[model samples]
Target: MRLFLKFIVVGFLNTVISYILFIAFLSILNYQASYTLSYCLSIGISYLLNTKIVFNVNRSIKSFLRFPLVYLVQYIFGFIILYLLNQYTKIENHIGILIVIFLSIPLTFILSRVVLLKKIQ
Candidate 1:
């Protein structure tokens, strides 16, 4: 319960950071490129928060290296959902983005918590 709450908090913060950066970059770059940049930037913040706050683990190079995979999976999965929603429901792009992010939070939190907290050995 506590972990999920923490995850939601961090995820909301990350989503704000991501959307701001995405819009900023979107003006100068293509949609996919802007989204990629924002997503990557959010991963850094997410990693720090998840390690120290949610998981109560010290930062590790091993965990950091693996961390992007979580976002990568989330990104791809989210994009698919966004695309489907857009196709079927004519949802606005930003709204689709929000829905996608909300849907992805659980899987992203689970993968990071389980894999990032374990010992390498």
Candidate 2:
């Protein structure tokens, strides 16, 4: 329970930072790079925070390599879901994104715990 709460807090901070960066880029540059750049940057930060602070994961080279792989999978999954929601639904983009983000939390927790933070067998 406590760990889950920590995950929410850390994830919220990380998401806010990345979302701000995404908006800034969109507002200033008006480029078609909002989804990719923001997702990557946020996920990277999230992975680091999750492992080191949220989970107190034991650091290792293998863990470092695998963590990014897990994130890449999650990133791709998140992007596809968000894009589809934005295109197919009447909901606002941010709201749709939030829906998708919230839905993925359980899946992400499973992946992070089983893959990144799991004690090596």
Predicted structure with the largest TM-score when compared to the true one: 1
Give stretches of model 1 more than 4 Å off.
119-121
Model 1 accuracy (lDDT, Cα): 0.83
Model 1, 13-94: lDDT tens per residue?
A: 8789999998899789966677778888999999988888878887888889988888888889977897798689978766
Models 1 onward score TM values of: 0.87, 0.81
Model 2 C-alpha lDDT per residue in residues 43-93, reported as the tens digit of each score: 668878898888887777788777766677777787788778767887765
Model 2 gets an lDDT of 0.73
**Lowest lDDT 10-residue stretch of candidate 2:** 26-35
